[model samples]
Target: MALEWVVLSYAAGAEAVMLLLLTLPGLDGLRKGLVAVTKNTLKPLLSVVPFCLFLLMDIYWKYENRPSCGDEHACTPSEYIRHQKSVMKSQRNALLIAATLLLYWLLFSVTHLVIRQQQLSQRLEKLRNED
Candidate 1:
């Protein structure tokens, strides 16, 4: 569980860095490379959607069927363990949702950039033709 948190933290940090790099000016050359990678990786990135749904369902199920933890003094050892497990499960599900959201953001950014580039090219072509 601890390791999952660490991995999720790193993933979130990397996504932030990628977004920063994409938005920074004076990096037009890097932009192309980033977009290319984004486009190529999109198909695989889509695989996250189903996994995210699964995580969400699992979280819902856990929430709906969770056993009562009762008073700390009255809680059995097994009940305490079950409560801890539920807490960990919730954390993992939240992390998965965050990662899925980040993936979608990256996809949207890449598609928007591609469309803008195409529009610019078309406008330039029309201008040249009018010359």
Candidate 2:
């Protein structure tokens, strides 16, 4: 039961990272370019929305299912241990996932930004030559 919360926490952290990556300027620029394509192609890209929504639902369900750490007035020794362990494990997993996502997002954003920058430079050069 405790482990479930740990996993859910990790998942939430991961989702947050995903949201950040999707919205950040570098990524957003690439997404905008892709969106300019035909609606048929955009349909496939839009699929990510439903998929993310489903993931959020699953995370919430798992989090809600975890048992409460008894009442504030009376808590057993075993319950205390379990709760502590769960919180620790959840934090560890969430940090790990966040780090991994950050690394991947950095690499992805840099690559896309570089490509876009090159394209812009070429366009600017062409305009200057035309003048």
Candidate 3:
């Protein structure tokens, strides 16, 4: 459980770093290499999608199966504390999940745009040289 979240965190962090590098200015010299790396990485990083879905379903299952701590007649003080902890954990995990998905989407879109711009610029340069 903890391991899953750790992996997800690493994936999210990597995506963020890649996205940052892609958008960062003054790396024109490295732009080609960055674009290549980003293109290659985009495929593997896609695994994060299914992994996120699994985590989401896990969250849902846990939520449905969780013990109700609100029953005053049933839940002890310790149980209530545990319930609060679980709820907090779920919220935090959900936020992380959302962030991870969003980062992936942004990274993919940015990489595509970068590649398309490069292609268009190259074509324009070729046409100019032909004149």
- Provide backbone clash counts, one per model: 0, 0, 0
Tens-digit lDDT string for candidate 2 (3-108): 6445445544544454454446665456545423322333343443454445445545656775677665566889778867866655564454445445445544
| TM-scores of all predicted structures | 0.64, 0.39, 0.96
lDDT of 3: 0.95
Kindly report which residue stretches of model 3 are placed more than 4 angstroms away from their true locations once superposed.
Answer: none
**TM-score ranking, best first:** 3, 1, 2
Better of 1 and 3 by TM-score: 3
> Against the unseen true structure, what C-alpha lDDT does each candidate score?
0.68, 0.53, 0.95
Residues 1-131, model 1: lDDT tens digits: 45644644555555566666666778877777876676665566566566556666767887888777666447788878979987887977687677756756775675578659867988999999999
| Tens-place lDDT digits, model 3, residues 1-131 | 99999999999999999999999999999999999999999999999999999999999999999988564558888988999999999999999999999999999999999999999999999999999
For model 2 the local lDDT of residue 127 reads 100
- Cα lDDT of candidate 1 equals 0.68
Candidate 3 Cα deviation (angstroms), residue 62: 0.6
